[model samples]
Target: MRTKSEARKDAIMSVALEVFREVGFDAASMSQIAARVGGSKATLYNYFSSKEELLLEAMLHSAEQHAENVLQLLQTEGDFSQQLHSFVASLLTLVNAPETVEILRVAISVGGTTDVGRRFYESGTQHVWTEISSKLQEEIKKGSLRDVDADRMAMHLRCLCEAEMIRNLLGAHQRMSASEAREKADCIIDIFLHAYGSTR
Candidate 1:
């Protein structure tokens, strides 16, 4: 079902991710990845234009499944507050994942001097936040939420969801269990609703 080219590319991305995690973006080199993949540097170049591109692609591939699950959770129908709680819980799980946290560190570290940070945000983070903003806008129209900026409200919710993310990135996070995540989500939703719940 899978072509050899596809398989080879997957292998390359897998090795690249491992190398990036091991040494970070600055210390990682194309040659090191090529060696790990048992391929020539030229072959590696054919797959990815640069080390930064490879890092982004590899990290994205690694986190794709979890991100999709989180997004899918967002689409499930529920009471607005319940939906927000579920979304927050799912998001916390995703962000606290080891691979996801590593990618975030990579983004923050390289973002100051390179396009990788901007591109990574635009590619994934922006899309997720936009979905949240859209949900907020719908609730605002229904007068369930206060009539404030949907984007800003979404930003607030995201901030709440990731309140512990820095600890994860620093390898200091204690990953939450399902009950713990749900409880944390409840706290976040309560704060958000307290601030934005309509007075009706």
Candidate 2:
């Protein structure tokens, strides 16, 4: 069970995500988030120091939750294709969330001009690619994938998966039937194998 404080923090983040999505990060004020959360500005400040902090906190919160979910999936026993399917499914589920999609929109809205947003872009969201690369390395060590530079492999995987994710956000995909996602995973696995799969 979550403590009250933890629950409250999640609630605030959920509310903030909505406000941030509707108005974007810079345009959305702390007072707006506070009102959306049914609190006053001062109380909201007590939880998040500033709008930038709140934005970073919420995005990181989503990413941390996703990383844990993927870790759990990796823990379950599966063959290479199955493991890849699991990974794709997990990634799809997280990025497909409406709240998550909206949070992403606001993050991009910040653009690359500002230092704070740029740092968040590079270290925050960009860290996801690194995490995926780490997972790719783990899978390779387990003989689930062909040996390759996990960093480069992860970059390509991100491109493939993110294309689908972005389409889903645009309403061009409807969560992709599990079978469809699995097929996509299998295709990517085939490509990976062609490049680096062990040849007997």
Best by TM-score: 1
lDDT values for all models = 0.83, 0.73
Tens-digit lDDT string for candidate 2 (56-147): 78777766777777756655776755676677766766666666676776776666744555766676668867877787788788776677
Candidate 1: tens digits of C-alpha lDDT, residues 8-127: 999999998788877888998999999999989999999899988897787667656556777676677778777777878887777776777776787788989888888777876787
RMSD of each: 2.3, 2.9
- Regions of model 1 farther than 4 Å from truth: 1-4, 62-64
True-structure lDDT of candidate 1: 0.83
